[model samples]
Target: MRTAYSVETVRAAERELMDRLPDGALMRRAAAGLAATAVRMLGWVYGARVLLLVGGGDNGGDALLAGALLARRGAAVTAVLLSPDRAHPGGLAALRAAGGSAGPAAAVSGRALVADLVLDGITGIGGSGGLRPEAAELLARLEARRPGAAEPAVLAVDLPSGVDADTGEVPGAAVRATATATFGAYKPGLLVDPGRQRAGTVRLVDIGLGPHLPPQPDLLALQHSDVARLLPLPSPESDKYRRGVVGVAAGSARYPGAAVLAVGGALRGGAGAVRYAGHAAEGVVAAHPETLVSGGAPREAGRVQSWVVGPGLGTGAEAERAVAQVLEADVPVLVDADGLRFLDPGQVRARRAPTLLTPHAGEAAALLDVAREAVESERLVSVRELARRYGATVLLKGSTTLVASGGRPVRVNPTGTGWLATAGSGDVLSGLAGSLLAAGLDALDAASVGAYLHGLAARLAPEPCTAVEVAAALPSAWQQVRATAGTD
Candidate 1:
């Protein structure tokens, strides 16, 4: 898994390392990595024009020391000190000794676009709120210089200026970086939205602080290796009954395709048997012959290890009845789509079995009785809130899919392309997740693994693939997961 630590965790780790190392060792280590990245970004350091937007803290120190290194290598490096009084004296001395010059912040106006690179050292983990007035003015001037001109490659030290280091929320104004060279570890802000969009390609510089950190991560992205371990594998003695059965209660006469898509996803998912219990059983059987068709409610449906409710289940009496039946089932339940719309947190809480809710922004908004925009704005908070309210795991889908169980750290799915946002996608996700739940994975693991596979399948598909294609791609996705198990 790709783990992200909070700014507080990173600061603590840095502090521990600082206590052990020599006085200026950490800054030098960070600067050396920053200089190397700048060199790679510019292709050649010699004769290149570089501009550094120096701030007041160690963030500026990193940029100054890196500028000094580039200056010594024949690059024309200039530091525009935003706070000259608090600038790192050691770094400034190093730069002057290496032939780099310091200039006023106003020097950025005309020459910024001509420079090969712009190092944004305006803020770091210690910073709060938006950019200071002077820094904001300089950025505005730089932004106005070019619409689509080939300007300098903007690189940020620690984080892009103006982004919240802790929450990843770009409150007012933030710098748009082409690349960010962060020290120690990945921050939560870099993994979450708004802030994630501003932070382009993120590079982590090993300043030897990894060992001082805690085991629990604030945010995590499942990689192929994580998926491989979490994925259910069958043994030689496994049978349809032994492996696990998934029961799906989805679709209506109005939307038969949802049943087909859900069953399609279930067939490809790692389930021993898939039972379809709804009005659309014929459609499910027609699409997937392997699925055992049952024309009744989920409660009366034959034995199933897990149940998936929702997905094209239209609102009204029938949908509510289906939802009610699934809630009372003995096995784990995954609720999605229209089911999420008709859900009651009290009813979900009363259930004896584990329940998982998968809702895109709209469904999540409906569940919370809040605006869809609110859920999107604070995705982590929204997911956790929903999980706490329903006493079940909640997966909020978007650019960064967040899965949160009550009191557990949220798991963010960083896999998948924008193509996964197409119609009927949630149905496929629900089916796959339900199958994993049937295979005995906990609510969080089922949701996270399913999302990871769903994304990997979309990525593997020819771009612009439909939901059916995503469902069809699950087998290959699982195969890829198993193939990379030991290697990762």
Candidate 2:
């Protein structure tokens, strides 16, 4: 798993490491790593022209020292100080001694400077709100001077300039880096977006802060091997009953295709049998003859290990009854789509069994009675809030799918694409996750694994594929995950 720490945690770890090391030892370690990264990016450091946006804090000091190292390698380096008087004295002296040029921010005045790479050390982890007026204008000027593929590559020092390291929030204008070389460990902002979007390709530079850090992370992202281990596997002695059955209370007279899609996703989700109960049972049976189809209400759906409710169940009283029946079941339940609309928060909060609520930004906004923009902008908070409010695992689905289970670190899904936003995708996810729940995976594992598979399938799609196609590609995605895991 790739883990992320909050700014406070990172600072504490850094302080601990610094206390044990000699004077200037930590900065030297950071500068060496930063310089090595720059050298690799520059290819031929001997003739490369490097530009540094030096700041007042350690972030700028690190970049300045890196510039000095590059100058020793015959690179033409220039340090443009945002705060001339407040710059790091040791770093400044090193740059000057190495024959690198240094000047005030005004030196960039009305001039188009060309460089092989631009290092953004304007601000770091402690920065809050947005970019300062002077820095913002300077970056704007630099951006205007260089545009498109022809522009110099930008590498941010530590956290990107103008991003909240703790929240991953880009309050205002921020530097969009070509890549970022983060020191010690990953910051929360470097993983979550809109800060994530600003940080291009993030590379962690070890400065030996691991031993001083906390045991747990603020956020976690699962890798393929982790997912492989979490997925419920059937053994030679596994029977249909032992494997478990998933009940799907989805679709209606208006949209029977939802039932078909959900059933499709569930069948491929490692479930023993898929028991579908709804008005669209006929359509579902026609699509998949193997499904145990029944008419109306979850109580009549026979025995099921888990239930996937909502998808296209509509907003009628019958729909409300269906949600009530499924919630009343003494098994794990996944609430999604139309099911999310009619759920009673009191009932959900009072449930003894696990409940997973999968909601997009719009649905989440309606539930919280906040604007859609608010939920979308603060996804990490929104997901965690939803989980806390309802006392159930909440999967806030969007650009970055997040699964938060109360006090646990929110799991940020890394394998997703814009194409996964197609219609019926969430329904497929609900069914798949529900199947995993029936197969005995916990709410978090089911949601995270289902989301990972869903995203991977979309990425593997050759072209613009529909939700059905995405579901159809699941077996291949499952095999692919297992295959990769085996190698490890």
Predicted structure with the largest TM-score when compared to the true one: 2
lDDT digits (tens) for residues 316-410 of candidate 1? 89899998888888789999998887787898898888999999998898889899988877787788899999999998998988899976778
Q: Which candidate has the top score in lDDT? A: 2
TM-score of 2: 0.97
User: How far is 255's C-alpha from truth in model 1 (Å)?
Assistant: 1.7
- Quickly count the clashes in candidate 1: 0
Error of 2 at 290 (Å): 1.7
lDDT digits (tens) for residues 1-488 of candidate 2? 88899988999999999999999999999999999999888788997889999899999999999999999999999898999999999999999999998888887744425688999999989998889988998888777763453588999999899988877878888899999999999888888878899999998999999998888899889889999999889999999879989999999999888889999999989889999999998899998899999996899989999999999999999999999999999999999999998877888989999999999999999999899988877878888889998999999898888899988989989887888879898888988999999999999999999999989998887578789889988998898999998554
Candidate 2 positional error at 301, Å: 0.5
